[model samples]
Target: MLTMPDVRAPRLLCVEVHEGRPLSFLTETAAAHLAALAARSVFVPTTTRTRKQYRRIHLPGPPAPYAICANGGHLLVDGESDRDWQGAVARRLAEQCAPLAEVLAHLERTAHPDWTRKLRTAEELFAYVVTERALVPELWLKELSDWAGQRGWSLSAQGSKVYLVPRPLTKSAAVAEVVRRAGTEVVLTAGDSLLDADLLLAGDHGWRPGHGELADQGWTAPQVTALGERGVLAGELILAELLRRV
Candidate 1:
């Protein structure tokens, strides 16, 4: 497995599977910086992970007032999805892009047993499939991306999963709402995936790790800083940069 260097820095436990069972770790430097940033800024978590998965990782700070989950298919406030926002997102997805059922049908038609493990619909807004990354066919992913684009959807092949998400169902939309609610003018974000493009773009400032879908595509924007470190170290670098900038 590819792993980043465990640099000699004070470390903070970020995720744990069970009592005394560590799952993820971050540098204490990054943790303290993030905690200070949270105290002064509107700190919101934006991710492609489902709410359940997002909840598993703990950060050093007060609870975020808002979280964008399921690749922006759902917005969580105080750990729960805001029903009104969810309804609005569903309506927009229905009105603006191919239905979830249609996308699922397309996936079914193009299914390849060599890579696919399981297909799942999330929040009835987007779909993704667990795949053997080494077995994934590049041409197949390209085809899916082209097809989804034609239908106002997008395909993101990241890690062990391939996500098919509607164009309107975006993290930016939910984050914008959070900004409005908080009345904050400054927004900063850090992410490493193609699914995070919108969220990163929408923010006043953002950072992307030197790995994941965005880095693989060589994506960049004027306000976004691209770091060279990859893997877990890339994550730490992002937090460090976030602290430095804000």
Candidate 2:
């Protein structure tokens, strides 16, 4: 929600690939609005990215005091993973879901190499398949989703990565921990994917852009606004609306 999806956009790029590929862009207005929000609010970045991947983007603001990474498998406090939180997550996953090894083996058996580029495990907490998005069959995805759901897991496809994550590990769970520590009551959130559903629901108010899995699925709730704006413009609008509500 914070960066442009298109790499070739003329807008100023604030997020880049480690190899300097300019993977994502952010407009100046969005940057300014984000800075303003950071000055007044907690401004935690909740993302599905791993810690290493999340660190690659440099947004305009003071570094966030806390961040939720790896879809809530890892919680970072001032850039360091909290061991206690990690241990708790590990315990929950062990008890509530099929083992990661089982999930990885299933992917290896099912994923077609013609479309699947790589199968990866992130933070040893979840598995994902990197595939050619267009070539990935919808029927195959449905089968995989169904298979995962039966095993106390879930699937989400964002961009080229198809994530297989345990149902117990969620951004909202991590956010609740943060809220408990910070003693905050009101929560505002913005996201565009099915994976973000829990976080959006946990928030007192939320927003989702007009494009993404949530948009395609026509997902919304009483407190969440489905914005018409998309791409980097949607990012700016989200920050502006967050500031207004704050």
Candidate 3:
């Protein structure tokens, strides 16, 4: 839990829109905890965000040595994507899942423009559709999920975005690479979405907020602690707990 719930909050703005408007903020306490955690450990920001999108957030801490972006399709080392890693991921996706073009064409044929706001391809690895959550039919979503599943892809709807990602493109895979390079045995992680489920499971210890797709599904595991806090408060608690453990 590392961000403020209210955009209007006076907390330290950590993420911003392309136009420079505040998108996410971190409380001073959370910021301090994150900074401390970074000082002691290899703090990696693992996310489903594309490399460009991940760069928008200025998290409070020394810059992380590695970041897993595009759901592990790209690994950033010192703010630049590792080309060798990208090539490996590309090969994996080519072997494991249906091509991105096929998925994109299916969406174009099936998705209704009335509900779909935009269809985007991230890192040319996966596709997502921005939709009005309420307007999206459950049956359509289920069907889409089934279709993706059959093709070695998975669908997750978080907030207003529905992601159709290749099953092999996972954050945990990239994190393992980082761990190997860092030569660390103990791994800790935190996340609050379906995309993050694998990462949480891979960690020796992990945490999830009371909100997001995983929380909504009541997902949990023995090594993962499920917190009751929501929003940015949850982010603060996660960082605090991580700081304590490290």
TM-score of each: 0.90, 0.94, 0.95
What's the lDDT for all of these models?
A: 0.82, 0.91, 0.91
Task: State in Å the error of residue 24, model 2.
Answer: 1.4
- Residues 1-246 of candidate 3 have per-residue lDDT tens digits of 434446655465455566757777777778889899999999999999988888998887799999999999989999999999999999999999999999999999999999999999998999999999899999999999999999999999999999999999999999999999999989999998899999999999999999999999999999999998888788888999999998
Clashing pairs in 3: 1-234, 1-235, 1-236, 2-235
Report residue 86 deviation for candidate 3 (angstroms).
0.9
Per-residue CA lDDT of model 1 for 28-111, tens digit only, reads 666777788778777787887788778888888999888889877788888889999878987898788888899999888787
Worst 10 residues of 1 by lDDT: 1-10
Off by over 4 Å in 2: 1-10
lDDT of candidate 2 over 161-228, digit per residue (tens) = 89999999999999999999888889999999999999999999999998898998999999899998
Local distance difference test, candidate 1: 0.82
Question: Once model 3 is optimally superposed onto the true structure by TM-score, how far is the C-alpha of residue 92 displaced, in angstroms?
Answer: 0.9
Deviation of model 1 at 55, angstroms: 1.7
